[model samples]
Target: MSEQPKPLPLVISPPRRREKPPRHLADLTLEERQERAAELGLPAFRAKQVSAHYFERLTDDAEQMTDLPAGQRVEIVQGFLPGLMTSLRTMQADRGTTVKTLWKLFDGALVESVLMRYTDRATICISSQAGCAMACPFCATGQGGLQRNMSTAEIVHQVVVGARAMARGEVAGGPGRLSNVVFMGMGEPLANYKAVIGAVRRLTDPAPHGLGLSARHVTVSTVGLVPRIKQLADEGIPVTLALSLHAPDDELRNELVPINTHFSVAETVDAAKEYFDKTGRRVSIEYAMMRDINDQAWRADLLADVLNERGRGWVHVNLIPLNPTPGSKWTASDPADEREFVRRLEAKGISTTVRDTRGDEIDAACGQLAATES
Candidate 1:
């Protein structure tokens, strides 16, 4: 039997604040944008135009939004977008197809975003917070500690930035649109529930107000925040919910994912089932495969049993290959063990896949670059 890894540092999550983040137009609704426009002495329609440029056009540069008054372009851009975060560095992989960017927020907090372009579709992995509060021992970001909940605008900005880069032919595939988004980056999204939902709206709502992407294409991941999961289901948004259920049993989960103490494995899976019922989207169980730690064949069977008990076809296991942080005792499981784990789950009639860990040289795992840089 293998010993459980040492418990990592944890942050007691404070209550989510109702206070709004610093001003950026992406944070505002159409009505709010109009109100702010009037207050800024710009015409109400001007707000819509700026939004079209940002959301519809995916470009914040005043020069590109040339239909607007030439002199006023700069003014509106400054007042609305204002460039909330600056790109400190960008590292690429896969022949410049996979790009990871490290952004410095206005307050100097660091977060990361990754853009992966394939032949058929492009996906961008975005961070919901500067750092994470959920102390998942194997996660690099969780180990670092939570910095602050990213604003709705801050979250949307990452998508817009990635989209803009794609449109600019910066990536290998010349000028394409970002088709999918995964909240699998830095923070536990549900921990910052309100802003993440707002970001979802900003990403999926129709043009002039949002990027107009489909809700089905968007995925919001959580560390099993039960109430928030229920709240999100009621929101009528059917974005895919990915639960970070790293372990299937409460005892090991309690040690691997400290939040399991608050929401047990049984209750967490129950919440996930509820989400699937409400949204009609299958819940993704994200289990990070670690060497000699929670990666045994029996654990995989138990995971399948748990999901099967919930019912088949409502849950899919996404086995994420762990990217161990520097000097970490835990590491990814061996290929043979990983294959066997997958076989056990499939034999139980549970769908499973070993996720593609892209951007290896660029530190693909969340918070690695920022954690190292900071």
Candidate 2:
């Protein structure tokens, strides 16, 4: 008999690092920042001042920090706010309400983030890593494979940048606050667990210490990293967990999201339920509907059954219409099929909603622009 092909090794952690990104104030806790300032022979209050400028005032320029002595301003800013990532290119759609930016990290690794402004709230979807390790076949980020994991500050900077844009009225809307953050950009957030958690803390901590966003307003996505999901439940942070369970059955999910081979659909769902039980935060089931693949009416029934069997009211099904990559075989599901799929789930008493698709013209699918640049 012909031998079955060897399975590829899963990248649960990033490969060895080449060089680490420089430290920034956002990466440090308040105490650590104060200690660093003392080591630099500056007053500890300088640390809080710099934090205010970055997190509160949304300015990194030393010149804008008039409170500090002119001689010390440059040193203080350089010590805390070394440049991290720069916008390589930016594209906008939805009348400039949806802006997508491709960022070049210090080492030239590329990532992308999307800022979406709506009537009630402004949201920024930030990347946790330059590329992804979860080789989910349908996702642009997963197609490119993994680069080095990003530092805590690198992830937080994306939000600060987006928040700055909103605060300055750079987006189509009038000046507003960035109220939401989703770790659904270019990487598997859980795979970079430590940095992702640090970023979450930095974002939700009170002003001068961090961005002060409510933990409820943050969502972190993972492709069934079961252990990480469990660890997150015990972290005391109530950020919503989004499990990208693209298929209901193991046989299909193993192919769609490669991580399923390590953690089965049953195991993944169980972890998600435990998360909801512990945190009282409803887990979001993210399923991208691909035409004729995982989008059939029967699969919808199976999905509802899978979720319902876990117990009700602990999950919400978010149906995303697949954003097909250029020349990719997968395309968005037919409207009729999508409607039927939703009908089946709703009929089964599963709370379901179709996602508002945005940023198609600007390659808003996480890693598409970075992939294109490469």
Candidate 3:
């Protein structure tokens, strides 16, 4: 008799022997930076100086760091800010308000970030991993499988570069501050929890120690990493949590998000609610509106019931227009269907909003450009 096929594992552990990224200052805390400087035979004060130039002044170029002594400037910058990534390609859309950059990491892994400028704020959606292991069939990054978990510095550098562009007015609109960061670019952020949390700390830490962005402005999205969601709630940081719950029922979600098979819909939603209860930060439920797949009007009502079952005013649904990949079967839901889905959710008192789909011309869907390059 043929044995039944074994079920797939929930987490795809990173393959062995992947080369680690170069160590950078952003990977270290302020005190650790001082200790490293001492080991380099440089005074402790130099650490703060270089951090000021990089974090406060938004420059990583050693030449621009005139405050450091000429002899030690190169050593300090090289010791701490060794080049991490270089732009392989950049595309602009939305009348230049949205700039997407494809960055080649030191190990030749490619990841992308999109800097979006709005009337009131500038937000950069950054990648947490070079590729994803979540294996969401509709996602480009997940199809590519796991490359390697990104180093803490690699993740944070994306934001710093975007911030620099905004400060210099390189990304359309006048010089402005980067007010928000979203971990919705390429990978399941919580799967790389330690590094993601470190990056978050660096982002919210004060200038000279970090970028100093407010914790409230940071949002980390995961594909229902239930245990990690609970762990994040315990952490004092109150960054918003976004659960990419494409379907509200186990039958559909198991196929849509394979991880759901291990952690069922009820378990995932419960953890998300616990996060909200602990942090007092409302959770955002991400639903990709797929044509004839998970976007039916009934699923909207079911999703509303799923959330309302937990409690009132604890979650909001952000509907994403499915950005179909090249030659893929998945596509965005029809306008009428999308509108009706929204109406259904709102009718049940679930605050909902359709995500502003941008940069289709620039291959803005996560990992599309990188997949093309590969």
Candidate 4:
């Protein structure tokens, strides 16, 4: 018998130092920006001027900042608003209306953001963490484990880049403003609670501080992090909260969302109810329809019952067809099962809709390409 080939030796590379310039406006709040500008020997008002260019004008090139002193424009831009996203690759589908970009960060870390342009609006999906800690068996990013929580600025910069790209008509179709933002990429938003909230503020604050998008236009999804859910409700922002409840029961949820081990289904539902009570904004329950796992008719009925008992008219169910990662046993539910799931929820007087799947061709379902590349 031929001898088996020797296994290839594993080679480990030292972490690459973060390259590119360091100034990132997304990392600072309005006051902090002013403070930094003052320390840099620029007037505090310069910070607001820079912020207007970034948030309102959606332009970063100092040359276009005609309002600033000609000589100081370059220094202000370079010292405070350095480039954060370097587009490494872009893949488009849905007739170019949906585009996914793989960006190489200053640290050489690969993260992705998707810009989906529709008839009336454009939405950008941003990342909260570099990888993920949830470790859901069916998820691509989770399998990679958590690298680190992205700074508030890093998270907001993703949106600004997408917004700028859209406004400049760099994406397919003509230029348009980004209307919505979703934290549905790469990492769990609630896991990086403080930074995610800070990013939200930066996105919603008016010009000279943030992108000026309405709070209602932002959606933050979590895998039922109970404490964070309560904390988010208290933040006084009315951004929609989406709970990624893959399974309705404790047993299956424990297997699918590992955090369910700490907070049971009952506790999670109660927390969801508390959020609604506090914010008066309808909570969105996101269920990914996995074939043969959480797609059974009984689970659907149970999901309806739980929502009905917890609170009525204060919750919406968003059914997502599973976007299977390569080599994963989990797959999307059949059409028949998906229809039945919706029917059961509607029967309970709960509002329901299937999420429009976009950018599938670009591995848009978070961390799939990054994991494969890594």
Clashes of each: 0, 0, 0, 2
TM-score of predicted structure 1: 0.95
User: Scored by CA lDDT, what does every candidate get?
Assistant: 0.89, 0.92, 0.92, 0.85
Residue 130, model 3: Cα distance from true site in angstroms: 1.2
Off by over 4 Å in 2: 1-11
Model 3 scores a C-alpha lDDT of: 0.92
Strongest candidate by lDDT: 3
Global lDDT of model 1: 0.89
Q: Please state every model's RMSD to the true fold in angstroms.
A: 2.6, 1.9, 2.2, 6.2
Q: Could you estimate the TM-score for every candidate?
A: 0.95, 0.97, 0.98, 0.92
Q: Which stretches of candidate 1 lie over 4 Å from their true place?
A: 1-21
TM-score attained by model 4: 0.92
lDDT of 4 by residue, 242-298 (tens): 999988898888788877777889999999999999998898999999999999999
lDDT of 2 by residue, 109-219 (tens): 999999999889999999998788777777888888888899999999999999999999999978999999999998889989999999999999999899999999999
Q: Model 4: how far is 259 from its true place, Å?
A: 0.5
lDDT of 1 by residue, 327-373 (tens): 89889999999999999999999988999878888898899999899
